[model samples]
Structures are given as structure tokens and as C-alpha cells.
Target: MATTSDPNQKTPLEIREIQELAIAISAKNINPTMLSQEFLKQTGIVPNEWELGKQPVLGPNLSQVTFQNGVSIVAQPRNITFMESIGTKNPSELNIPNIARQYVDKLSNAEYQGLSISPKSLIPFPGSENGARNYITRTLLSPGPWQDYGKAPVQAGLNLLYQLDRCQFSLSINEAKIQMPDQSSIPALLFAGNFNYNVGSNSPQEILEQLKKGIDDWSSDLKDFQEIVNQRFLAQQQESLFPGA
Candidate 1:
């Protein structure tokens, strides 16, 4: 028997823009209070001329700093994360990876566990507020009688994990709303990718080398993510929204 495609079916969502990129390192005995602006300058982790975007948060267990260039550093007891808003800048221009490598090099005494490089983006669906929700419930998932049990429409999200040769990759898709500058909000899908690498060595030098290698391979991982999202998940589009991929 021949199966016919539904004519009323809507188009699958495509990635609209790259929203944020981040590098997070997990370690032991990390003192977040030590991440001061003066300490960052003294250690050469950040340029001396760079001004802070806001007042630095220095606490016993957590610390945070935002630079004027849209780079933000957040440190907790178990991990430290460096994030930057992609905006219109090319991903190649990002320096957070270099900064993270420098930090690990300088703080060689800390016991590093693993690191993850993540890229987050917004996938906008055309027409209607329920586009993303419908994509998840009706498209990605199998239809069953369970969907009719809910009073409101089903809200769903997906998380997939894949073990690659060099790293463990995970992609999460969720329904989200983005607020515009005019105070209006629109429905969208958020595609988040994480490439997690484990540093197996206890030696600081070995850990630093491992982390540097992960950072170096981040661009390729990002490209892989782009291919997966664009070719496999979303509409059949060959063009990439992310620059330098």
C-alpha cells in the first residue's frame, strides 16, 4: 500500500540563530571567592584594559563577573563556566576557550575532573504559538491515547545523548519563548548541544593538555552539531546559520 503525505503538515523548524556558547570545567576544591577582577588581571587570564560590565559577585561558594564584551565567568564550588553571547560575532572570534585554558594552566594545583563545550541556539517555528509544542508532541513522538488524557496540550522536551569517540555528546530541544526588544514574545525551540570530555589523568599537565585538545576540537564538534540539527532534525536546509562552522 502507498502512503500519502499530509498536505496540511507544517514545515519543520530550522535553526534561526546561534544564541550562546560556553565552556564549563568541573574540578575539585575550587574556591570561587578567588575569582576577583584583580586576580584575573594579575594572572593574565583577562586583559587589564577590559572593563567589567557590572559589579563582580564575590562570595564564599560562588563568584561571577561579566565583561563589557558579553563574556561572563561564573565559578561555583564544583565547577567554573565561561560563557559568551554570540550575537553577530563569528564564533572564531571567541576567546573564552583560550581564557579557560589559561585558567587551568595557572591553577594547576586544582584537581580537574572534566570539561564540556556547549552551543545553544534558537529554532523559530512559523505561525501559531503551539508550533514548537506540536513539533515535539506530534512529530518527534509517537501518537497514542495518552496524549488525550491531559486537559491542556502536552508540553514536551527531548534530550538525547550520544557517545562519540572523543567525547560524550548531548542535544536537548525544548519549547521556549523569546522576548523581543518591543516587549513582545514569540514561541521558539531551543537547541542546546554539549560535548563533554573526561580528563582521566590526575597530573595537572596532562589535564591541561586534555582540556586544550578539547578546546581545539570544539569547532569541529560545533560543525557536527550544525549538521545534525540542520540535516537530521530540522527542515532539509544546507545553509548554516552559525558563522565559522
Candidate 2:
């Protein structure tokens, strides 16, 4: 399928039956550094100072921003699953019509709630960059609405699993016990806005940051992780290859 270059396209080709939830609120009293420190403390990892200078401070004027994400959960077709399994030594079969409908219904409800808010009326992030800096620092959506922090949309799938209530959609993850239910479910997070959400040009530092954030998930499958990194950097490489294209 040909991907649409039009930014205004209602739905992108890769996304199917996507349901989004957007929440805009004042980001006051939310220090991303403090949050990061807390997260590091909890994770038992030392916070690395990259000499990134000061992460931009959000003043009162631009403090109000949307905290939003979209989800696309669909039942894998038999043929698609088979195609996906072609080279595998052991391919597992799927139980169709299992929880697909239930998830879809939940996404529909999320979309309904998301649409109630008017993003246009709210103030946009000031400056050239359309995405908010604080959100990127905190990684509200791990694996990304921001890829600079080293999280892929796929890893974000795991992150979303934790956010969602199991009662609505049966899913769980336990690292200590090494337990993960619903292996078939693939999840991603997307940002919706009138303006672009890209954070300037890709830099080595940002890429390094992204690598650090994704290192844990990277170990299981380096090939898959490399693909995501390649996709993230492709646009920049293209722009450099054909400047002023």
C-alpha cells in the first residue's frame, strides 16, 4: 500500500481502526528532571548527564499542552499470521475472535472521549519545534510519540499494556516472574496535532539517548531493534541525500 505524504490524512496507512485519547492540561508543577530522577531511583540506574545543557523550560504561556496517544488493535488475519510465520521453525496458531472485538470496543470508547476536547483552541508549543520538550524528557509514552529518547513504537506497545486496565482487556506483564500474557497483541502510540511534532533535526546525542532508552528491549532482538532505528533515521538520511528535494 502506498503511504500518504499528506500530513492532514485522517488515517495513515499503517494504522487500522485506530482509536485515540488526547488530554490537554496545564503542565505546571511538573518538573521533568524530578520525574526522571524518581524513575532512575526506582529503576536503580544512575542518571547520566550528557551535557545537554538545560532542557527547555515551559513558561506559563506554553505550559498548556496535549498529552495524547492513539492505539490500533486488530485481529490478525489467518493468512497474515501464516505469512508472518513462513520462516519460523515453530509457528503458533492464533485463536480468532478471541478478545479482538472487546479491545476494539474499548478503543472506540477511548476515541469518543478523545474527540470531546478541542485541540485547536489550546495554545501550541511556541518556537520552531511543534512538539513539547518536557513531554519528551519525561517519556510519558515510552517507545514514543518521541523516538529521540530511544523508545520505539513497538516498545511503547509494552508500555501501553501497563497503562490499560486488565478488566477491560485481559493483559499483564511481570518481569520478576517473566510473565507476559496476550503475546499476539501488537501496540503503538501516535500523536495527533495541527502542527508537526518533530524535535528539530536528528542529532548524534539524541540518537544515543534513544539507544540507551531502548537498550533493554534491544537485547531480545537486535535485528528488529535495528529496523526501528533505521526507520527513525531514514528521513534525516533522505533529506541529507537529496537536499532541497
Candidate 3:
């Protein structure tokens, strides 16, 4: 994923290119002491260790330009390991070639990280509601971007697109809330790391574990209360979507 200089944009980027950037900024790598030292060296602000919330940032930057068709983008990742399968859905059906699998993993992880943070994975499982919530908050939400959703449109700077069918996604900005027809369709965002870094050398599993530890420590009692409210809201949403289950 090499980058080319474009004179028009503030950054060197292409107009319609889809790129994924993954980095391992784990807790062990970026602790309060390290972050404070770096911030002090750069900005001289001596940032309060608590202000950062000590979250572990993982995965790649999922940045993309407009789709080929002008109004839509289809997300059919080739290879990924889901927590649970979506019925009989198969990754091969997505039609992404073997050479493109690296892209698939990068993009999928990005989507997973984004969705897990805001409100995607907040819903409780049928039998183990608390267990499900805690797992997500600890494993995924804790180390991932739990607080990214509110600032997604701005900080992430990716337009919200609706998933009309399967991997099909369409751009819709008429309303404040973005909709998705398929849960797997991930929107785009800026890549936060250097693209020239070695691609085949990333230790994915170890990096993920490191991130999880960071988030687990950074989380607080307030996050748990928010999860409760989110759970209730999700339950209500389910009831509205399906009257009787």
C-alpha cells in the first residue's frame, strides 16, 4: 500500500483509492509514562496521565475515496475470523482474490474496531447478557476505540453510508444517523500510520492482546453504567424491530 503525492489535498492521497493501515500501539508500548514523556517533549503540556483514558489503538486506517460507481461501495472482505458466523455466510463468496486477502483483514479489523467502539457490539447475547457486555467492554471496547463514534464523522472524517443489501453500501447524508443494511459493511477513515511500514511482518494476535490490556485498565465505573444504558436501548430497539421473538 504505497502512497503517491497529490498536489490538491492537504495530504498525499488519491481521490478514489481505498487503503488500509494497521499499527500496533499497545499498552506496553504506550503507557502513561511513555505518553507523558512524548507529549512533554513535543507539546510541553505535561498531559495528565488520566486524561488519555489509556486506550490501546489497534488495526489499520480504513481510508477510501468515492466508490467506483459514484454513490456506493460494497464491503466483501475475503478473510476474517468472526466471533460468530452470520448464519451460513462464507468469506469466499465475497469474491475478493487471494492476493487481496491482506486488504480484507485490514479493512475488516478496522470495521470491527469502529463498530465495537460506538454501538455495534454493545448488545447483549440472548443467555449471557452480562457476560457478553463485559467481554465486549473488556476485550474489544476497552482496548479499541470506545469513544470514537461521537467524533467519527469529524475525527475519522469518513462519510456515513447505508448498507442496502449484503455487502452493498450506499451513501446517505440526509439524516444525522447513518444506516447499514449489512452489519459487515464498514465505512472509511483516515490511515493514522505510515503506509511504507512492513505489511507481512505484523504480529496481529500479540498486538490485539496488548491493546486489550490497555483498555481494561483505562476503563472506569462510568463506562460500565453507560454500557447498562446502551444495553437497555438495544433491547428496546430489538423489540421495536421484531414485535415477538
Ranking by TM-score: 1, 3, 2
Comparing 1 and 2 on lDDT, the stronger one? 1
Q: Estimated TM-score per prediction? A: 0.86, 0.16, 0.18
What tens digits encode model 3's per-residue C-alpha lDDT throughout 115-175?
Answer: 1111111121222313323333443334456444674321212234333221222221111
Q: What are the per-model numbers of colliding residue pairs?
A: 0, 2, 3
Error of 3 at 204 (Å): 14
| Model 1: per-residue Cα lDDT at residue 110 | 81
lDDT of 2 by residue, 109-163 (tens): 2121100110111111212132222223333344434455454322221221112
lDDT of 1 by residue, 49-141 (tens): 989999999998889999988789999997999998776677789878778888987887788889899988776543557876777888789
Q: lDDT scores for all predictions? A: 0.77, 0.22, 0.25
RMSD for all candidates, in order, please.
8.1, 24.0, 20.9
Cα lDDT of model 1 overall?
0.77
